[model samples]
Target: MQVLMRPWGAMHYRIDGPEDGLPVVFANSLGTDLRLWDAVLPLLPGIRAIRYDKRGHGLSDSGGPVSIADLAEDAAALIEATGGPAVFVGLSIGGMIGQALAARRPELLRALVLSNTAPRMGAPEIWAARIAAVRAGGVASIADAVMERWFAPPFRTTPALHPWRNMLARCDAQGYIAACEAIAAADLTEAAASLRLPALVIAGDQDGSSPPDLVRGTADLIPGADFHVIPGAGHLPCVETPAAWAALLAPFLQDHAR
Candidate 1:
C-alpha cells in the first residue's frame, strides 16, 4: 500500500530484502501490478528488491494518455528515487521502459534484464485496432484472448487464472488504453542496440506475444547481452515457472552486481 507521490502523480511501490544489499528493481508487464513478481521475490530474498506499478497499472493513479517516453521517464524517476545504479529487471512493457530508460538515463542502471518483451510490440495498425477494441468494449473485451496469449496451456487451467482475470478486469480502461498507446508508439531498436551495460534478455519458449526469436532479436541488439529461454512458459514466465526464472536470473545478477 506504499506510494511515491510524484509531482505528476503518485506511484504505488513496495520494497523488499535489505536496503544495504544489491539493489534489484522490477517493473512488471502491462495489465499487471507489482504482485507480478510475488513468486519470484521469495527466491531472491538475498538481494534488495523494489517493485512498482507503472502509472496506470496496479494501485497507481493514471495520468490520462501517455507515450513510451513518458513511461520511461516515470521509471527513471523511480530509480532515481532509489539512488539506483542497480540492476533493472523489466517484463513486457516494463522491458520496453527499461530499454528506453537505459538509453535516456544510462547512468542509473548497472545492468538490465528484459523478459517476454520487445523493442516494439506490434505494428501501428495492430495497436490501433487493439486500442479501438478496448475503448469500445472495455478491458473485458480482450481479457480472455490476452489470457490465452499470456499463459501456457497448463497455466490456463490452474487456479492462478482466476486472480489474473480479476486483476485485468479491475484495471482502469483509460489506463489500459493509455499503456496500449504507449506500446504502440514505442520503437526502441536504436536505443537497445546502443547499450553498454551488463544485460540479460530472457524469453519463454511458448510465449505467443513476444516469442523467443523476437526476444532474441532484442538481445542481439545489445552488443554483449546474454539470452535465455524458459521452456513450457508463456509471456509471464515468472508466474508459470518462478523457480526456473530465478535460476536463470541469479547468476546474471551476481555477474553484474554493483
Candidate 2:
C-alpha cells in the first residue's frame, strides 16, 4: 500500500513483478480499488505491473472535478512517477482512461489493454440521474444496483460478493458521482481509432454494462487490436474468471513486450 499525492488528491497504488520486466500499468473500474487486479496479477509472469485506486475509490482521497482527462492525467502521473512508460491495462472506466490517455499521451505507452469497457457508456441523462441518486441517498443508495450490474446471479452470492458490495457502499459519494459524470461525457471512438500501439480488448460474455459486441466494437476501432470474450464472467472478468482473462492477456503482453 502506497500513496501518490497529487495536488488535487492522493491516489493509492501498488507495484509488483521484477524491476527489469516489461512495465504494465493497470487502472481499475469505477467503484473499485487497485485490489481489482489481485486475481489477475499472479497469473502474469515476468512483467512489472502497477495498479492504483482512482480518487475516491479505495484509499485515495475524493477531491477535484472528475473528468476522463483528469483520470488520464492521474494515471500518467502515477506511471511516470513509479517507472516511466508501460503498457496500460484498464477495465470499465479504467478502459476509458486508457483510451483518453493513449490519445492524449501516446508516447507514454508500450501496449494497451482495455477490459470490459466501451467507446462511450450511457447517455448524459442516465449519468445525471445517477448523480442525483448519489446526492440524494449517498453511495449506499446505489451499492446493490451497481453490484447487480457488475456480476451475474451465481457469482453475486459467492464469497467474493461481500468485499465488492462493501467497496461500493463505502465509496465517497462525490467521487463516485464525479466518475459517473466523466463516463457520461467521454466518447473515445475517434481517439481509439487513431492509436498506433499494440492493443488488446477483453469482454465478459454476461457483462450488461459493456456487452461483448460493444467491446468488440471498441477493439475494431483500433487497427490491430485483439479481442477476447470470457465465458461465464460478468463485468469484471478479472474477478469472476481471472484465469481465462489471464490466458487472453498474457499472450498479448508477450507478443508486444519490449
Candidate 3:
C-alpha cells in the first residue's frame, strides 16, 4: 500500500521481487488498475516489477484534464523513483503512454512491450459519446459492453467474468471519463514508428477493441519488434490467459534483461 505523492496528486503503486533485480514497469488498460498484472507478475519472478494506477484510476487521485503525454510523465516519474532505465509493458491506453514515454524520454526505458493496443483507438466522436453516456448513467451503463470487448466468449460464462464486470462498473466516473478523453485526443502513430529500442507487440486473436491486425500494424511501425497473438483471448490476454501471456513475455524479458 505504497503511495507516491506527485505534483498533481497521489498515485498508488507497488513494487515486487528483489531490490537488485531487473525492473519491469507495467501500466494497465483504461478501466483497470495495477492489479491487472497480478497473475502475470507471479509467473515472472526475480524481477523488480512495478505496477501503478494512473491518475483517475484505482486509488490514484483524479485531476481536471489530461493527455497521453501527461500520463506518460506520470509513468516516467514512477520509473525514475524506482531507479529506472527498465523495461516497460503497457496495455490499451497504457500502451499509448508507453509510446509517448519512449518518444519523450527514451532513456527511461530499456525495452517496450505494447499489448492489446494501437497508436490511436476510436475517433473523437466515439469517445465523446462514451463520455456522455458515462456522465449521464455512470460506469455501469457501459460495463456490459466493455466486458464483451474485454473477454472472449468462453471466459464470459465463467465466474471470473463477474469480478471484472464489477471492476468496470465500480470505476470512478470522472476518472473513466478523463481516460476516455485522453484516448480520444491521442495519436501516437509517428511516435511509435520512430521508436528505436528493443520492443515487442502482442494482441489477442479475439480482441474487439484492438484486433490482431491493428496491433500487428503497430508492430510494423517499429523496426524489429516481434508480434505474436494469444489464442482464445480478447483485449486483456494477460487477464484471461495469464500463463500463455507470461509464456510469451518471459522470453522477451530474458532477452532484454539488464
Better by lDDT, candidate 3 or 1:
3
lDDT of each: 0.89, 0.89, 0.93
lDDT of 2: 0.89
Instruction: Give me the runs in candidate 3 sitting further than 4 Å from their true place.
Output: none
The candidate that wins on lDDT is 3
TM-score of each: 0.97, 0.96, 0.99
Q: Show the colliding residue pairs in model 1.
A: none
Worst 10 residues of 2 by lDDT: 56-65
Q: What is candidate 2's TM-score against the reference?
A: 0.96
Clashes found in each candidate (C-alpha, N, C closer than 3 A): 0, 0, 0
Can you give the lDDT of residue 191 in candidate 1?
91
| Candidate 1 residue-wise lDDT, 145-242, digit = tens | 89998999899998989898889878888899899889988899999988998889999998989999999999999989889999999999999899
Error of 3 at 121 (Å): 0.6
